[model samples]
Target: MAMSNAGNDYPLSEVPPEARKGLASLAMVLLGFTFFTATMFAGGKLGVAFGFADLLLVIALGNLLLGLYAAALGHIACRSGLNSVLMGRFAFGERGSKLCDLILGFTQIGWYAWGTATAAVVLGKYFGLEQGAVLALMAVFGLGFCATAYIGYRGLEILSWIAVPAMALLLILSMSVTTAKAGGLAGLLAIQPSSSLDLSTAITLVFGTFVSGATQATNWTRFARSTRVAVLASLIGFFIGNGLMVLIGAYGAIVYQQPDVVEVLMLQGFATAALAMLLLNIWSTQDNTIYNFAVAGCNLVRTDRRKTVTLAGALIGTALAVLGMYDLLVPYLVLLGTVIPPIGGVIVADFWLRHRGRYPLLAEARLPHYNWPGLAAYGLGTIAAFGSPWVAPLVGIGVAALAYGVFNGLTRGRTTAPASL
Candidate 1:
């Protein structure tokens, strides 16, 4: 299909022309906070229960590594304006790129399904509905998501702007209240259970919770005006915003010592706050899933791109929702979480190690069409990640990076390099 984009690039184009700086930054920041509530409280709560110091250490380290890779991939998306699946062509060749898209599309479908289910759960609880009713609400949410998917990135950006701040404010307010209830920041810190979390589990959860967010990051970064904004946005999003969210979880843990404090806190004074937080969290994350799925769907069809996206969203959403598998979202997220780090590892290796200082594959329109070596490397990375549950997702990521770097050295001799020196 012939594609055009006035002066700017088309939605799934390979190169995006310059855009408004503030808009780009705003979009990214908003995107960053989509998982703020979930990641912060959920991951942090797990950490505090396991061990506070250990959890903080785990979170810090995971964020640092995850941030580096996310920022790099995000920079590429921002500067190139290519939907991430299209960008994979630069790394995976044509057929390999297709496979990458399918993998990404499938994973994104899972994410969207999970997000829909989460939205349903939140809405159900807020409205005092039953599970069956929640499923109906989930369907409605899924429909809204599909509608937004059709409207494209502009709609997503607007949704991001509205939902991001709403979520953030709720997070801040909840954390503040939890802290005050606990006595203060110091008091919150002092409260610890008899059996604390181990250091490794805490760190793994930190990496695990945000792994999905990190993987889907390019969906928003593609709109960035510059690499600086991309990196800064990620830094703020993952580091600062992530820190605040985790602290909220920690604060919740400290204030409520009971077994089901997560539930209790929501029902107590934090009910309204939790509902807002839940809705915002679900919407924010859902937007990204919808956006990426749209991109992947467009790439898959390459004809009637808009219709392709709508169809893909509906089919995937319906299948998942019908399965009534909301409870499965977290486990699936954990699985994807482990799978993604390795992809990030390969991206780092490809962009940084082999390419030297330029993105030759991106610059060139064509490459050796079937890049089997890249596939092998990615496969090996996947294998490694799957086997390394103890380390969570890092195992696969590490393996993928090494395999890609070594394979690139032996086969292609590093034609492409990082855009930044």
Candidate 2:
């Protein structure tokens, strides 16, 4: 179908006739995986704070399951050209969709800021620069990200080509060095985690990590030419890319005595690989996030989608580069981490229960401008994600699903039409 600008606009239908390519398509699948690997490593560091071997196991298992679910998210994005955030519109109403966009967009900003800051610090420490100098360095990188984002998704796709391979090599190199340092795989296996794992916590971590990876699937899937390609690419990302990154990251804790030390090993393998990987990884991830924001704008306004997305990226990227943004971004990151899973739950439930092989959401003109049920369910999900102590983040998602199901069932008769791409 030709893209119609007369109604609600979205990129899945707006992408020019020739912008799609196999490499660019595959990069979309890897985008979320990159962020996920970073989170798993960070989560492992946090797991260390808990101090129980069993807990780590539980978390690892939870993250694994979540990863599987995330891998499947590509089906939605690729099948529908709608970016993930905009996909919510059919379920949440156009206005309600804005909430999803705002939250996800902010989370992306945090990722960009945290990543740029991290790279700056890594570089600064390596060069023996002072704290003040590190902040300055991050500012420079942040500007570069903004500049690239402003050029649009095409530019981002090119950046991803460079980043994905670099990150893969860094991951491989880290695993090799860590194994060698620990006296090989056998020796690394012998070293045990000091943390304990309960089934619930483990499940939460596994799912948490999975949702984390999935958040970007829709953005990339929007470019996929076919559902089969999208699903296959996503499987590779979930099973191959993420599997290796986590296996290496988690094992790094045992072998290197510090997971973050993976970078140290990278530095040793070839000078600057660590820094290069860090920069490229963040660049790859940030561009996808920026693309989603652009799509969100297309949904909200009739103006040029690319320009709006670029403006959003520039503003968010610059804010993230400013001093002390990382410290503030951490809590929000955790909140975003929690907020995402419920969305996956709703997406899965909506696809399975409400649509049942028919995408009611693909026809924008037929959709109600305001879907209170969707809005209510979305709010309930966020609230649910907020309640748990150990995994309060998931509360919103779990609760939202149940609430939506119950509400939709009781009503039993609203023929909500899907948004058309």
Candidate 3:
């Protein structure tokens, strides 16, 4: 977490080759990204909407798709040794990349607030506490959540060491208990969906839970030793780790009519277990979320004041959670799910197609002030994404890629100094 060395500049000009890691270490870090409680909540929504078979199909294929997308970016990151916001510098321009930093970073704040609010409100609920007390609890939890992010990636890796395995065991326990309550998987398959949600919407929600995070896959994957390591790590983290979260959430919803894994655990008379689950599950994600905000903020402001920026970000996100502004951000988060993937699309195009899968050094990569082609592609992609409901995020990605290829084919735009300076 001590990102004080020139070799590891704040926001990372490039991860030194000597610092690169193999599949195991990178996988561990990427795994932290998938260990998100919101994924479980999204799974619960799908559980209520579709039958057992349908739900399994949605979760598997939906996340597999996202995993592949993230892996693609991971490959790019490992090859270039660049994080997402820095990649935006190539595709979106030095100044235009700030938009990438803002959109990607602020979304993390929204997630931070939402995760904090959920944890606090539920913790308060079990105590039969009032809304005012719940708000106070949000502040307390928010501070605790910000601690790791303040330390950066090292903090995330350390927290994941204890939290990931413990959280997985609890989820498995909850599944076992719930499966028994449903008289086993056969009976669970027989349970009818309480409501109908279209397959497209369910899949969208599945990806939406982590698509923004998916775009940011480069953040951790830059640590990978090779493209193979990056790709495999991302696939395992998002596919297996993320898939399990959805399955657990779906299982809880189908058997107990509860959308929350922690709530279901509590209802099963594992109140203490639920508390542990709440702390580990939400805390693992909250710290990472705030850490992400710090990185993005540092990129946006072009500063090395990551700790100061982290504190400011935590204060802003905590205030939003306590004031209930996170509720207002939820719909926006959904819209962001549709809008943000285009950034990835353009980056993929610029990295693979335009550059032929190679890039100049980040410190010396002369780029345009504004890559209008990339921005235009993203704009068109976002519009096209909302025009239909069938796989909105994927649609955005495809449109952005195609449009970027077309626009980037034009004469080279004016080049400028790299933002890393």
Q: Write the per-residue lDDT of candidate 2 for residues 1-421, one digit (tens) a residue.
A: 2333312223534343254446444645365335443654744543443433444454455555544565556676665555666567666655666667667766766766776677787788778999888877877777666555565555665676667766766677666766687787566545655766555555555556546546656666556777677766665666555555555556556655555633546545655666666666666666555555565555555344555565666566656666567778777777677777666667656655666533644544355666666667767777767767666545666676787787778766455544444
Tens digits of lDDT, candidate 3, 25-74: 66766776688777888888898888898889999999999899999999
lDDT of each: 0.63, 0.60, 0.83
Model 2 compared with the native: what TM-score?
Answer: 0.82
Q: Flag the better candidate by lDDT, 1 or 2.
A: 1
| Model 1: per-residue Cα lDDT at residue 192 | 62
Model 1 regions lying over 4 Å from their true place: 1-11, 20-33, 50-55, 130-132, 257-265, 303-311, 328-330, 360-364, 413-421
* Per-prediction TM-score: 0.85, 0.82, 0.94
lDDT of 1 by residue, 123-182 (tens): 676678987887678778787766655665565566667776766676666556666776
Error of 1 at 224 (Å): 1.7
lDDT of 3 at 296: 89
Q: How well does candidate 3 match the true structure, expressed as C-alpha RMSD?
A: 2.7
1 or 2, which is superior by TM-score?
Answer: 1
Question: Highest lDDT, which number?
Answer: 3
- In candidate 1, how many Å is residue 246 off? 2.7
Itemize residue pairs with steric clashes in candidate 3. Answer: none
